[model samples]
Target: MKKILVVCTSGLGTSLAMRLSIERFIRERNLKVKVEHADMGSANFIEADLIIGAKQVISCLSKQNDIETIGLEDIVRRRYIEEQLLNCDTIQTWLKEKEGLR
Candidate 1:
């Protein structure tokens, strides 16, 4: 399973909310990915296949080339998250692989 790390400035409420949203999205789509949350300080140290957070936070995470990152303008907007994630090449490829597994 792919790992997703949701980050926020404090590793508190905002990150938890984003993690919840991502978990819901994954569950609804039956995507095989593990989701977790962390603070900005811990993001770089975490081993996640994907790092998702606000644009500002994600920009910092993006510096590392190995992990995929998704920056959202609005952290709690489920529709926006779904739309952006659908447009992500990594997510699209994962979706295709998931479909093939079925």
Candidate 2:
């Protein structure tokens, strides 16, 4: 399955919120993927298809282009997750494959 990393300042409260939001989106869309959370300072590195986080967290992980990164204004909103991820190729392809089911 595809993997998504949701990052935040400390990867605790705020990041947890984002992870939950993304999880809901994944469930609602019936997408086959996994979502995870990490802290900007402690994430070290990530192994996933996409990384979603605030500007700060994204900046920290920007050096690694191997993993795609999406910046978010707010970490706990489905709208933000949808807006940022909709145009992503990973999401696009996944959605295309699942479109018939929906």
Candidate 3:
């Protein structure tokens, strides 16, 4: 299963919402995945195959452990959660490409 960690300011509202949306999206497609959430200030407790966060938090996480990050601001808009999930798919593709290159 793919492991994903989502980070946000408080790790409450947006993070929880995104996690649910992503879970549903993957389940519908019968994909195996796990999603975890953490406050941007305290992310060390969780390890992930991918780390996704709001744009404001991306820079802080960029240099941490070589995990791929998907910026939420670039994808979230007009209160739409599906848009963020679409961006997640793009991130997944990028990860696949990187793995292929190796």
* Top candidate (lDDT): 1
lDDT of 1 by residue, 1-88 (tens): 6888899999999999988888988999998899999999988888888788999988776376667788899988889988988898
Off by over 4 Å in 2: 99-102
Of the two candidates 1 and 2, the one with more favorable lDDT, higher being better, is: 1
Task: Tell how far residue 69 is off in model 3, in angstroms.
Answer: 0.3
Whole-model Cα lDDT of every candidate shown, in order: 0.87, 0.80, 0.68
For model 2, residues 3-43, the per-residue Cα lDDT tens digits are 99888887888778888888888898888899988888656
> Can you give the TM-score per candidate against the true fold?
0.92, 0.83, 0.68
- Best by the TM-score measure: 1
Which clashing pairs does model 1 show?
Answer: none
Give the poorly placed runs of model 1, Cα more than 4 Å off: none
When 1 and 3 are scored with lDDT, the better candidate is 1
Flag regions of model 3 displaced more than 4 Å. Answer: 74-102
The TM-score of candidate 2 is 0.83
Error of 2 at 3 (Å): 0.5
